[model samples]
Target: MSTAPLVAVPAAAAAVPRHVAIIMDGNGRWAKQRHLPRFAGHKAGVDAVRRVTRAARALGIEALTLYAFSSENWRRPEEEVADLMGLLRIFIRGDIDELVRENVRLRVIGDHSRLAPDLVAMVDAAVARTAANTGPILAIALNYGAQAELAAAARRLAERLAPHEIDEAAIEAELDTRDLPPLDLLIRTSGEHRLSNFLLWQAAYAELLFVDTLWPDFDAEALGAAVAAFGRRQRRYGGL
Candidate 1:
């Protein structure tokens, strides 16, 4: 699906949001509609990732979180899931050097125990390699679910603190995104209208946008237009 080509922010638009999150949706649907294998869409989705990552950085977004793989995604057909994993491996192998060149810090949030050992190790290696970069962050949400993240954070609090000692701050400190900036704007493509359990905690105050553009079709224009729209919103954080 095509989107607005104009990304030029008007004077009325506010400063760019610092932290942006995206639910990259519609890969399977994009493939199905094109009469191609779903993995074809996923492969193209990789290109979209490259485009969006560069756009986010250029837009001065301090942090960019992408919903790469979800915990629920494992329920898909086993062969498809395997294909997704294979894609991740190839993407990392092919793209990590570019990430380094871009000065983007790589991070992953979610349960690592369920992933393949080699995959986890590879991801860790990539993160470690990019640990020194000071540019905009690129957090990949792999096998991540927000509700599960909340529960795990709570579990960590329980392990170290008495019930009375555990407070909001304690729980917040244990979240995977504890050190990241507050979520500013969240975008979901493919015309999806729900969060699908991605970043439930961090999105508490995020400005939300849903676009009809499929993930594979998303590009700088789509993302810049979303960011510009976010700038026009007057965020009061519940204040009058």
Candidate 2:
């Protein structure tokens, strides 16, 4: 049985989602398909990130959250992990100035306590330098897990209030994404149909769009198509 919801929003009246999140997948698969090194695919994925970020900014998206690295990714081989970190460092150092110039606010959301000090410093520098930018927010999730996020939020909520005082609103406020707009749409590439623990609490009512295009191959056209599909669906928030 399909668990998908019926589309209620008319195509003509559909508006671009205010907040969009993406689970970038299939870098390694893309590399294997091309008979190239996995890092090659990851490098290409960085280009895709640049393209999508610029496109999203041009399209006036309020907020864009990208699932960069998950807590589970640490289980990967040390060599691959090192390559990923190197790419991240390169991306941060090479692009922070440009991001600032374009007025894009950089924000990293996830547990950074276990990260290397240098990596943490770079991430902090990016955020700090762009702290005053009033443009679109680009939130990158690193070492993030939706279940962990919810669990942490619950822990915080429990510490701040009595059981009787806790409610839906209180829980929402305690979430890591409390300051951001509600997630409107989530897109996962590489033909993935599952959330994979990305933004579970924030995506309680978000529309999901899955594409077969690998992350490295994703381009502006891909993003446009997904957004168009989103526009065609009506979000009733469980109401008629």
What do the candidate models score in CA lDDT, each in turn?
0.87, 0.86
lDDT tens per residue, model 2, 66-134: 999999999999999889999999889988888888888898888965788999998998899999999
Error of 2 at 164 (Å): 1.9
Predicted structure with the largest lDDT when compared to the true one: 1
Q: What is the lDDT of residue 7 in candidate 2?
A: 29
Query: Hey, what RMSD does candidate 1 come out at?
Result: 3.3
Total backbone collisions, model 2: 1
| Predictions: Cα RMSD each | 3.3, 6.5
Which tens-of-lDDT digit does each residue in 60-93 have in candidate 1? 7789999998999999999988998998999899
Residue pairs with colliding backbones in model 2 are 9-234
Any runs in candidate 2 off by more than 4 Å, and if so which?
Answer: 1-14
Candidate 2 all-Cα RMSD: 6.5
